[model samples]
Target: MPTLAINNFNIFCATLGGFITLFGLVSYLFKEKYYLSEALISLIAGLIFSPHATNWIRPQEYALNDIEILDTITLYFTRLVLGVQLVLAGVQLPSKYLKKEWKSLSFLIGPGMTTMWIVTSLLVFALVPHISFLHALAVGACVTPTDPVLSNSIVKGKFADKNIPKELQKIIIAESGTNDGLGYPFLFLPLYLIQHIGHQGQGSDNSTRVAMGLWFGEMWAYTILLSIVYGAAVGWVAKKLLHWAEERKYVDRESFLVFAITLALFIVGTVGMIGSDDVLACFIAGNTFTWDDWFRLETMDDSFQPTIDMLLNVSVFIWFGAVAPWWLFAHSPVIPIWRLIVLGILVLLLRRLPIIFALHKKIHQIEEARQAVFVGFFGPIGVSAIFYLYVSHEFLNGITVDGEIREDAAYLKEVMEVVIWFLVICSVIVHGLCIPMAKLGFFIPRTLTTALDSLGRTGSDSSDDPQPAFQQAQAGESETTDAEDRLRRRPGWSRTGGDSLPTRVFRIGRSLMRSGTSSADANRAPGQAPLPVSSVPTIIDSGDGDGEGDASAKVDGKSDGSEVSTGGGGAAPSAPALGEDVISGRTIRFHDEQQQQRTEEAKVGQKV
Candidate 1:
């Protein structure tokens, strides 16, 4: 081929690589079930077709140096993409939304920090024989925080139970939002100790105190405080500028691009100059900026989310795939394959068990409790692991003596890099595939019921009473009844009781309708006739007096096929017939059955 033709072909190949990456994301949007597998396949194809890997096709002995350029390019690109994501995240934070959900925020912080500490500490102890305790600690801290970007894609609103407390969802989002930044100090602490510990020789005791003080007291504490303060300051200023631009009708689209880039660079420079964690500072700044009223960033968020998502998908899955050191599994000083498996299993279990136990007490219900545990179990190590490994390599490089690095330093770098890559790739695949599939069978019916009950209680306290026994029975018997018949029948009353019945029945009927039942289903059951009772209506009035009836009276009223009887006195009513309350038990059971049927139908359809 002519030289000009060859250059054009190479450029075309590069373009094709980019197209493959974009295609992976597009495929995910249309058919999420095949997302991971398709991304992985496309990434492999892109790598094979890329000009950068042409040397590998010639059967020459492979060397790391040959691929170094590609790796470095991808690494820097990932950082740039991550930086932009952090800035966008900061600029879009609904601080008011988070503030109102402080309980959820608190829940996230408590569990996340605790899990990080516990998992890291345990891993340090478990991996002590193979690796230094301090090194293990560093790795543990690095891997502890769940990647918010990854989790956000998986555990979003659609995947999560609708009846779950909004606060809990907020907690998940905010924790994922903030914890990666928060975990940086932990990532640095052990590495700092490993580096400076030997230099403190004869005065080791004093040196130890100083290092500890700096790591925990100054480095951790000061960095966090400063990031928050500086981030908030920047955010406050950005908010004002946004408002001014809006009022002047000068808030051009390009302005956002300029603002994000400038803010990111400024935060990175300032944080680096001050010896603080730049990533954390950037995240804090982004969060702060997003908290404002005038920015109305939700609009920007909607527009930018897909682009950010695309960038992240490419940066994480394909770019990383193209540069991954696939040869490292055959190399030395890394733990043997069997040992890695044992360690991986231990890490997953150790991380999951603690979180499960912690959340069980706070959240009631067995299935929801199980799901919480499952989420904890699958907290895969991601970009944070790479960040830590990079930091370790830099630290090791800085401590070289006589212009020569220590022999172990090279091994350490390789091990850290390979291990992080292994973990990240594995996590993306495992969690990515599992999250979608797991949603199928992970129903928490009791938790959902409790949530609905709580919402009903808090949203309107006046309607707090349980369904009456007579109404419960009528609803049960009327399941086969026509839609109109069910609607016309007053709640807690059989259809025979005409419109002349008291207003309480109408109120109960309304509550049932609002409780996610169609007006059709709310009517009396087919072939079920209204009960004839002189005493029952009077009893219902007495029991429901002042709208604070006995618990049994309310339960009976709500149950299927139950009946209520009032004595002569104005006291509470007696329990209705057993069948009256039976329907109450059936409502939830029926809903669950319907859901299961739908799920099965979907599966069958997919198969076909």
Candidate 2:
């Protein structure tokens, strides 16, 4: 074998791997403290080490700077991430959730998405010079769908589990997953028209009519109908086969965890060959796969999906940062920097918020103004936008020669890419910071208290506990009580507070450090202490629940596969079945068989 040359490729791999490792180490801290998203972190990393900056990792150079190669890489890479995320979303959702929320979901993806497209197109038409409404619609379609990868950051974390209502979280995730696929029709319609219209008035009205016919006959029939059918078929089959294998004890923990992703990739590949919507197929397949809820319940607790999702999402965004067309933003005069900035702001503000806010009352999922605002404000233009941008570019390339656009259609490819990139950047930063800012909002009262205390104008203190009133109520208190307490403790409602600014900040920092330590303890192997069953995490508690017997029996399920009771009684108390525990209102299944296998292996090692 020839000796491997140590070039930028190896350096890039090493650097990328190292950065991923570093991020992985601090990811929890970043999420807990700063509320930063992984996409935002990875993008910044890629930017810092990219060719345009330090030149430490030249991904574009690795592709030899060929536009076709870069686009191909981006397209496939994004395809994999979006497909995986959509399926993951589909699988994790409560069974019958879509059916139950059909009306609300339909409204979001239908009327809501249309409004976004229209507003975005209007913005693009007004801001960018010499762009037609059709091309602007195409660009608008690219950024209309909320990115699943970015939305996951908002919906699935510890903060969301506490702050966002479960229904609202599900709605956000469902909308992002469904609309990404639905956005395809919006994009292809405009693209088909542009292709038919051709360069500088070369096409006639008859060809335009043909394009309209093709849009329905070809794109709709093939991309939508076939995709949905094929997806449902694949999902049902996979679910059946997996269930069969599991019943036979042929499927282990690894296979159980890996199966969904493999199925998602299979859907993506097969759907791509048929020229159907792979992302939509993956979503549909996932829904069909877990329609009965068996698979989802079985694998709910011990999932590898989030880890896989994070890795793929981080990789795609990093690649995006490296290969972004910074030059296009800088040098393109027709779509100048000022226009791009204005368009980004207008698109962000007007795209989905107005529509969603206006229709919040009609939408059954949205309960209140705050929830509606939260949902409306977080429709981030991220990975999905990048994926569609390249799709539009490739389609335009087929129509135009050598990646060149006609004089009249300046909005087709070049200007579209610029606008999409700026929006993605804006979205990544803005949406990523949203939760952090909300967290900051929660601390504003305390900050004021600190200011007053430091100035020695502090009033009489009430409670010695450092925990906020809202936090105390979250510890199994009634919702009404929690709401009342929060209102009473709201800024200017009371002066009964604690230490000065510096001391309060220091104590909060120390509390976080201790919480991390306790979390590690909570996750320790069975005999120590049982994890808490309440909505609030065990780590946040002052200490573990007061007994050892309760801890061991709850964690280590009975050897005979019987339910373990909580209290000794004439009639045994109702308890979760073997290998399952209810935590935070969800059934968390443990791998009892896997644990037994490891125990036996340990015994064998001891005997040897």
Candidate 3:
């Protein structure tokens, strides 16, 4: 067997490396400040250096002028990228997150995904002339699943950490990762419809029922169900083996770092060879592999997987940009340029936003209108769409002879590829620029305010009141809502520096407790000066106070350098601190003194 020449290998590597090196210096600013993404950057590079522009890198020519070779490359390339990214998503999610957020995930992957498929099909049918409804459905199915690759741009960066809620980010990650594989059913349904009825002249209603049954058995049962079982089993076995090995000092850190990527590709290959849902299996396997949290914790701080994931993403986008059918956009005999633009715009706008927005109240993760809008708008059509495009092509290619599609299926193939690719390009651009555009007020759904208090500002009405401004703190029972509790309970939660919600509230409560004036000070005249900081009594309320503000101490007196009566209860041991994120009621005497001094100065100024 002969292989293609590596004539442009050095050029390709040098070009890509140079582009990556330049982008690396400013990537932080792009992600953290400007809100741009590698997808957009690499895409622009592909376009600028593509055959259509500089003709610097031509993949089509490399395939020896055979489009099937290029299409095959694309199909497997996307499969690998999607598989690895899905597994990474599975690993990074908090433990038992799927079980906890099952309700919201069901709504998103079920109704949310179906709505996108149907609406997109309708748009394709309406915009493109001479296209059958079934063919249009094929195109819609291609774009139905959100691209996990593109979504990482918005959901996993510093911009997201500061501006987006963690729950919302997790929802997007889970939804995108799961639905990409689930889209097989949607894509194959239309293809089966076209194949059984339109292509072969099996016009009977009974045959349609049979085709549906085949889809259920093959696509759903074999592909989905079996893939999940297989993936979970593999993950469990791998996890146990790794644990057993590490306990005996057999496994090293390097092997652990590569485990996720290795598992992802292994599942993708073995599962694909068995004709099951490879991408879904990859995610399921990853989730189960990290279910016990040992592997994730051990490798939590390693940048190996993330760095590799970035490299995969950058390469694919660049390849996609280079191989994109620019000629078809202007020269397609079936669909006009104006119609394609309209389809792209409409698909991007209507694909997921309205359906998700309508069902926001039902999704526990989506608590605010802004969150709903963000989730809805950020479902980008990217690598997964490209992957499905070729899958549709191969399915339609079955009826072709000598590289020419039969007349009946040729137009379907043309419309599907053209429309799908156009949407992908538009989605990559629109969704990639979403954050920066939102920042500039050119887009809706502006960034959310950071949940953590930045400047130590507590939830208090006025400092001059001098009563215990507890700010909704409760003893024993927590004041945090279910959503907040979920966030606080997430693994790897930081307990210091007011970053996490519970820590901020804890700090606020402790600070207020120490600086609070006594009941005698509260009864002073409106313009009367208050006592100095040294005279104030520090009476700590345990938040189990009656209507008269009476309570006991809960904090361990040994840790805080202060003691209060425990009433009838014994002092409890302090909670064990993880790493440096210890949550303690340690006294900041200088801070308390400065706060009291400011209060006294305020009262003195009021007296004058």
| Candidate with the greatest lDDT versus the true structure | 3
lDDT of 1 by residue, 423-496 (tens): 66666666667654554435465457556754554455334434333334343331222333354464665333
Residue ranges of candidate 3 with Cα displaced over 4 Å: 1-6, 199-206, 400-404, 442-608
Cα lDDT, all candidates: 0.53, 0.74, 0.76
- TM-scores vs. true structure, each candidate: 0.62, 0.76, 0.72
Candidate 2 regions with alpha-carbon error over 4 angstroms: 1-4, 203-206, 401-411, 458-608
Relative to the unseen true structure, what is the Cα RMSD of model 2? Answer: 11.0
- Ranking of all candidate structures by their TM-score, best first: 2, 3, 1
Task: State which candidate, 1 or 3, has the greater lDDT.
Answer: 3
Q: Model 2 over residues 469-560: C-alpha lDDT tens digits?
A: 32332224212222343455546543234233432333344444333333333234548665433211222111221111121222222323
Query: Model 2 — which ten-residue stretch has the worst lDDT?
Result: 540-549
Whole-model lDDT, model 2: 0.74
